[model samples]
Target chain A: MNAPAAQSVSPAPQQGGRPSPPALRFDNVTLGYDRHPAVHHLHLDIAPGSLTAIVGPNGAGKSTLLKAAAGLIRPLDGVIQRGVPARRIAYLPQAAALDNSFPLTVYDLVAMGLWERCGLFGRIGQRHAPRIAEALRAVGLTGLERRPIGALSGGQLQRALFARLLLQDAALILLDEPFNALDAATVADLTALIHRWRDEGRTVLAALHDLELVRASFPQTLLLARELIACGPTDVVLTDANLARARRMSEAPDPHAAPCVRAA
Target chain B: MHAIYAWLIGPFVEFDFLRRALVGALALSLSGAPVGVFLMLRRMSLTGDAMAHAILPGAAIGYLLYGLSLPAMTFGGLAAGFVVALLAGAVARLTQLREDASMAAFYLLSLALGVTIVSLRGSNVDLLHVLFGSVLALDDATLILLGAVAVITLFSLAALWRPLVVECVDPGFLRSVSRAGAPTHLIFLVLLVLNLVAGFHALGTLLAVGVIVLPAVSARFWARQVTGMAGVAIIVAALSGWLGLALSYHHGLPAGPAIILVAGGIYVLSLLLGRVGGLVWRALPGRHLEA
Candidate 1:
């Protein structure tokens, strides 16, 4: 990795969006597991309200970096500071490892988002009810508020969690593989929600494995393989050389975008 | 008629012993339900069991020192459980071994150590109280101590309720909000040890866990949410305690085992009767035709 492509380094993205005081900024972020560095010397400012992606191959530390940003894991070295004062951040984990035996309803599941605001001893106020209802409706689960999460199909379960994200009323959302194990329709539905969030001046950072989805949805990309390969506007970052290096450093190149090259 | 009256309704009106037992049972459930819920979630009820057995040695030593004071024995036991859990947590975090493996090691070592201490320091009567418990011997001071412990456990749970449930359900989300759950988990462990120690005289180590676990487990069959489950567990626990104590008083059977057996019975019934998915519930009509 070299300039125009930094090695063991991360740089400002070429979004022309005026860095925008990044809703999230990674200043020389060196991340990993057990003190073994995974993503190195990474620096990127996610433009406020922009839907930026940390895209990469299996061992590329895609999940690792996202986990770091979510504060689930502290970086081996470096800081991840949220823009603005401490804000409401929503995180949708890699499909909940929830005990299926738990037997919670979709309404109950979505309403959990209010836990931060409502506090435990108090009841969910009448004011919060409409938000819960609106969230379910937004996720196309209008009448299914009472549906047991344990009984939901994979897609429905995904949307229910989406409803939770909606109810969180958070400015920053970090989704880890939210699209995994979903059908095409579910993906389309979630993509629409992502689009809505980006349009609303809310910051969205999603870690995705699908290159085509990343290309279509996000303007800025953070390509990685334990080090940032390239991060900028899709056109600049998705170049053939970058894709090839990404592919070579990565496991398999999607032939759909085979050349991944746009002619001049 | 007298026997029937005593067995059926003696708990509410008759002996002060019945009042104490009833109150004791209610307190036990209040403390135990939340503890059981977390243990089941963390998959660390076995650690709770380890603490229970570990407390026996401290309890035995406390008795040797102070001659069978509930406060002395229970406080010593709680101290012992707390130390063991902290050491286990520390070992798990610092060493290559994971939490479950470290807890297992702590458990076996504690149980062995407890047996040694009891054999070395305890007399026959002390041995009986240490292992089997003395639920029949209800003193006013002991009841008050148990009641106070239950109140603190309930209030702490109420104050820390949502965070604890959220932590168990989704540590990732909780962590994302910058609330790492290790400390929260330690707090839960301490509460569990206190409940185990508090309920020790009412039900012995093995039997107390049964009383604590069974109601919460049984209640899950009826609840779709954490709050609902907890509420149901409290109700079932109190009911079983009152009824079992009354039955024991009437028949002169051991009160601890009687209460535990009632809880166990509820669990078995719940297992047979639980309805998890819509498939089983919806199958009732269609299956009737098929049959």
Candidate 2:
């Protein structure tokens, strides 16, 4: 299929309508597990208020890259610098990563987003009630606050998770497959919330599988297959040639098989 | 009415030992029941059991060295339990062995060593008292120890409540937001060891876990929230202690095992007839959702 023409998307204004610096920068970074590199030699900058989609075939290290950005996993080599503190970065892992057996209510789960401010000892006072309500309303989960999270359907649970992200009110949001297994209506609602976040001058990096959605909504894209295949405007990065290259590279075996050299 | 009063209140009113046993059991239940609730929630019920057994060797060693000294035995049991937990955690992290398997192995080794040590010096009667406890013979020092442990456990649990809940629900999320994740987990382990140590003084290593775990599991069938479950567990534990003490006084049975058996009976009853998630509820034709 033919790739769409490149579209120029402007960055949203910061608070007081001022321009902001880059939200994140990766300088020669390598991320891995058990000393086997998953994202290798990455050099990139994610500008503040930019909505970027990361897409590629399976084993593309998309989740690994996001984890590194969130500081959940340290870089094996080089550095990943963030403009904001770790608490100001919100990460929503895949739905399956959460333990549903926990006997937490939707309200209890959503209120955890305030943990950065309230901490372990602090109580959720009346002052924070409005924000929690607003977040739940944004995600269309208002009436289900008292319901147990385990009782929620998949779509409702996704909505509740989004409500939690809303309450986090972070400057940088990283979502890994937020739309997976969600219904079309839920996807549309969440996609709208993402756009609203971008418009509010928050940086959002989503690892997505839907190329059509990326092309339609996201202005920038990072295509990867263990290594950076292409990074630029969505139209330029999602080209037929780049996609084919990513697929081939992902399927091929490493020719130089050797023990990983630890960084000094 | 007089017959009922005689069955319930006469044992405590007539005998100081029965009164002491009741107080000790209630104190243990107040703290240990909540810990047990968290244990069941975290799926660490078996770990609690193993830790109880692991304390035996240290207590036995203390018995050998000091001859039934309460302080020595308490210290030894706490040390041994902590050591086993640390070793099990380290082994799980450093090696390919799963946590459950490592804990099981360590606990079995500890139990065997404990029994061997106890058999080396103490008479069979001493061994029986050590293994099954002498709740009816609680001294002033033991009563004071149980009371102190309950107070400390309640305060610490209150302070650590939020972090502990966050860790249990979503550890990765907790780690992402704050640096307290590891400390929270460590505090929880320490609390578990503390409760186990407290429990050993009243019910012995073999039966202490029953006092903690049975009431907690029984509460699970009746309550949907953690706080409610803890409350129910405390009630069940306290009730079992009261009834068991009365039964022991009337029939002259061993107090510790009698208490545990009462808790076990409640657990079985709750499993069948509780209002929250009981077997009876599941068997109902129209029931759909879990409480």
Candidate 3:
């Protein structure tokens, strides 16, 4: 069992001609729930300022990888190293994980993005109002400030979540299927936000199923099937051969499978 | 006006016990309703009920040891509720059982244990007092305890407001950004236990959740925001306390059940005619907002 060596390890040079260090690194990491490995022992390095798409079939380790990166799950083995502080990392879970039935206005929900700054007891002072408004406007949710989040359409709710993400001002953003069930317009709008984050030198990792979107926007890609299949430039990573392998590998997993003895 | 005054104001003015009950009810509502609102929002209303029952054995033990001592019962109940909550939460986390299932199991066991403990030595009347409570018999010490609990609950809630909302709405996101999520949740459980203990002193363990949950469920119909819901729940609970106390005084009804019944009636009314999303309002709608 050979560890898949990550291609594209050469990071883009920073302002002073120094190669910027990897923004994230997985050192022989294995992620799982209850010792049933959802993600196999693998190694990968994500460069700072890169927009990477993690593509995989259903039951693939895309979400598990993202959760581990977001510090929501501890690696069952090995380690995940992050370039930024935990507070400077933002995570947007799949829409289903959020409780929209909560009695909160759009304004209040979006304002929560300031948690890293305002903290538990800090006030959302007058100076922060403009940022919230700007985030809402950026996502085209300006007038819906007072509307309860439950009333927002699915696309509109995604937009509101994006607005919240914008206010997060994070260095590393982990989005778990940000465009699932969204219309084309909302996808385009959110994709543009992703591009803007890349342009601003923020690292963005999104797990997505849409291969075309990944080919179009994501420069780097990691194709996974409970284990890394291919990782490199999107065109090189999303080849027909790799896609077939991923589909085959992602078939119903055995819950009783024994642990791997091979070292990374 | 004279009859209204006689019916409403006369009870409090004429009787010290009525006045004490009124003050105790107001304090409980002021603090307990907000906690209830959050509990309802988090979909933990039944957990609140479970915790109410979970406190019974501790209070019973306190009764057996000290015989109706406020400090003994309050401390005992708090300790019991806290342990049960922690155990249930731990079981849910470490095992496959859900929190609700674990909580239900623990509370049922605690209730039976509490009853058996009390029935070992105390009379049926003592058991009834422990279960049903006597709000009219609140003493100076009990009133002070209620006031103190209310103050602590409000201040703690204000401080925990942000993290609590974040935790309820999107806990994964909160966990990503800060360490406040788990601590906020623990503190919220502490407050819930604290309030239930305070409420048990006035309404007894069986009826304690009445004030905590009934008004919160009713407030949902009237408000569309969390703060508004909390505010409305407080108002509803306070009003029910007043009206129920008065009705109990006049009719010789059991005070605790009377108070809970008033809250239940308000819930029904709110369900039908509340301003926000009531059945009647939704059924007969005339206005549309521009998109």
Q: Give me the candidate number with maximum lDDT.
A: 3
- On DockQ, the candidate that comes out on top is 3
Give the Cα-based TM-score of candidate 3 against the true structure. 0.95
Of 1 and 3, which scores higher on TM-score? 3
Instruction: Please report, as a residue range, the 10-residue window in candidate 2 chain A with the lowest summed lDDT.
Output: A1-10
Q: Model 2 over residues A1-264: C-alpha lDDT tens digits? A: 122222223354346765555789887788887667888777777888899999988788999999999998999887888988888999988764566777789988899989888888998979998999999999999888888878899999888888888888899999999999888899999999999999998999999999999999898899988878888789988999999998986544465758755332
TM-score of each: 0.87, 0.94, 0.95
| Interface RMSD, model 2, angstroms | 1.3
**Candidate 3 chain B: worst 10 consecutive residues by lDDT?**
B172-181
lDDT of all predictions: 0.75, 0.87, 0.90
Best by TM-score: 3
What DockQ do the predictions score, one after another? 0.44, 0.63, 0.75
Cα misplacement distance, residue B220 of candidate 1 (Å) = 2.2
Worst 10 residues of 3 chain A by lDDT: A6-15
Model 3 docking category: medium
Summing lDDT over every window of 10 consecutive residues in candidate 2 chain B, give the lowest-scoring window: B282-291
C-alpha lDDT of candidate 1 relative to the true structure: 0.75
Better of 2 and 3 by DockQ: 3
Q: What docking tier does model 1 reach? A: acceptable
Q: Rank order by lDDT, top first?
A: 3, 2, 1
**Deviating ranges (above 4 Å) for candidate 2:** A1-20, A251-256, A259-264, B287-291
Clashing pairs in 3: none
